[model samples]
Target: VLRLYHAKNVYYRIMRQNVLLLERKPEIPPSKRAHTGKVAVGESNQRWCFDGFEFSCDNGEKLRVTFTLDCCDREAIDWAASTGGYDNSTVQDVMLRSVEKRFGDRLPDTPVQWLTDNGSAYTAHETRKFARELNLEPCTTAVSSPQSNGMAERFVKTMKEYYIAFMPKPEVRTALRNLAAAFTHHNENHPHS
Candidate 1:
């Protein structure tokens, strides 16, 4: 046989303190939707992944970058780099540039998926609205989960290993210039298997 005791009584004895002094709090619920697992698409422009990365220069100046990549072709479509923190304006600029690069003056014929993590810039109300206006669907990864956006994460790894590792980044101007070349080379020369 078992005896049931009030929560307060059990807590008071276990903690050796007055249970009446303790206050219970409600918990935040989890999302109803499931996490996005695979980050690949069958065709180009069907989906694009966005992510930001940062590195420091030889002089100890930090450079941050935001980039968009086509899921199917794995092409680094457009990017923006700055010495400032990642912000909504920078994300919007990259979105506009990526659209211009892929579809020119006209927007995409169909809405393209814009997958990213739940970063403030990507999740800002203005940013989502702007993406909708541009014929893009902004979708964020699961909270505090990076693996859901694996393609972009892998791209960051490749860039850090192949390009940023050896490129001369003595200053911001030079680093930005090199970054442009790196993006071009990534699209044109680097092969993805």
Candidate 2:
């Protein structure tokens, strides 16, 4: 028994050494951690956060999902899914729909700060123009830091846990339909903690 324990310890020590040797250090130094800035605190409709998440269908087709959330109430303002890929157009469509649904035809008297990551779509010239036209102040999170937009990130995680995880893997169309219904229920009925 003593010999067996010694052999096991030696094996584990060698494996630990190998893992340490194989580990690659991060490009950014520990002291240079990404800063996400302060969380927004205001009335409903004043600040909104948005982000994108991706999942794969059973057939291996990728689906991109974008979601916007009201920071005040923690309500999901709007969301969109595209198999074709989320681009500047998709971002515009989602933002426009959200604004129209919440504020109707007329633009808001005060500019709404729409917070998002430094994604290509959010940073695009066309998207910036559209936001300006609709009285939206595009607020971007610090580069490489998603925690700055914690509300949107939490919503995405909740969505996957409550809806997407239980979905039938083989049916993309059905999953999408279910997702729409789930989103509505989540936004309208689900209470935030």
Candidate 3:
């Protein structure tokens, strides 16, 4: 229609002007951003990462799991599993449970880095605000770069290879029960070397 009316250039100019009106993301400071290949920490609670994964049951139902891990000790601090899709609320629950497990109902005296991928749940405004409220500094991995959260990525791989691959997947309820045991076993018996 623009070309037919000899207004193609006008349309282009209008689009160019309107482009600047699009929403822009605020700049995240360097210290609050997750750097690639920098997932390690010298001590527990200094940095923690969380990620989600999903697998199918024998009945073809999908079970999604989200987990929090300490960067220093490589411990699975807390985790949640569900047949439902992952969302901000699920991530928030894991964050609260992890904080409670580590600090015993008290928020961390220092802000701990909460590293995660740029998932909607992790990057949600509410989630980031909640993290700050809990004394956590939220940091997201670089876009399209999972290696920036390598520790959590490796943990997910380990869970899939060592635990999930061998476990019976009769149903979601049974799988959740087994996954809990797997997390416990990983924390207690798995070597962190």
Candidate 4:
């Protein structure tokens, strides 16, 4: 048995010669926006992304804002704010309604797809049931890989940054209004295209 094993010994070797190991994925790494690979954004309008954010209120309460983004043109196709939907079912409901309003024409036939992180809300039963009911396909990213849905992540980051830095953080209603105003400005004048 020892003699036979000795005869079959072969050391492991690198596979590709053109793309060297040292040349792959640089040491400093690119930003999440740069690292994001091609999604079939131009193939169809069915692809979507989702993320949630918390807005600080004056009364020590928080309002949760959830948004759905279309991968193409990188626009916020749907968004909802709630004082109660800190869970998956509520989040899914708002998202579904947004999609339904915009593309209700497709209804049962359109192959809608959504991408998100492994948030508990993303895995809720109501969300699962709704996706099946609407014939939507759901894809989740790796635990640490937020870049898979980097567009959505980027939007959320922008919202938090601008909303806090520019808008006057006042009472609940004023803050909400400011946020809405900011989003409108972002959508209309930012020229992200």
Model 3 alpha-carbon miss at residue 19, Å: 23
* Each prediction's whole-model lDDT (CA): 0.89, 0.81, 0.89, 0.70
The global Cα lDDT (0 to 1) of model 4 is 0.70
Between which residue pairs do clashes occur in model 3?
Answer: none
Cα deviation at 40, candidate 3, in Å, is 0.8
lDDT for each residue of candidate 1 in 93-124, tens digit (9 for 90 to 100): 99999999999999999999999998999999
- Compose the digit string of candidate 2's lDDT tens values, residues 20-109: 545667687432322336555568888888899988777887778997888888877888998887999999998998898889999988
Query: Which rank order by TM-score, best down to worst?
Result: 1, 3, 2, 4
TM-score of candidate 1 relative to the true fold: 0.84
lDDT of 4 by residue, 1-193 (tens): 9876665442112323434335456466444432244444884466777888887776666778888777776667667777775677666776777667667756646766777777888867778677767776777766667677777878888888865567876676777788778777777876457
Relative to the unseen true structure, what is the C-alpha lDDT of residue 148 in candidate 1, on a scale of 0 to 100?
86
Question: Best to worst by lDDT, what's the order?
Answer: 3, 1, 2, 4
TM-score of each: 0.84, 0.78, 0.82, 0.71
Candidate 3, residues 65-140, lDDT tens digits: the string is 9999999999999988888878999999999999999999799999999999989999999999999999999988
Q: State each model's C-alpha RMSD to the native.
A: 4.2, 6.9, 7.0, 10.4
Candidate 1 clashes between residue pairs 3 or more apart in a chain or in different chains: none
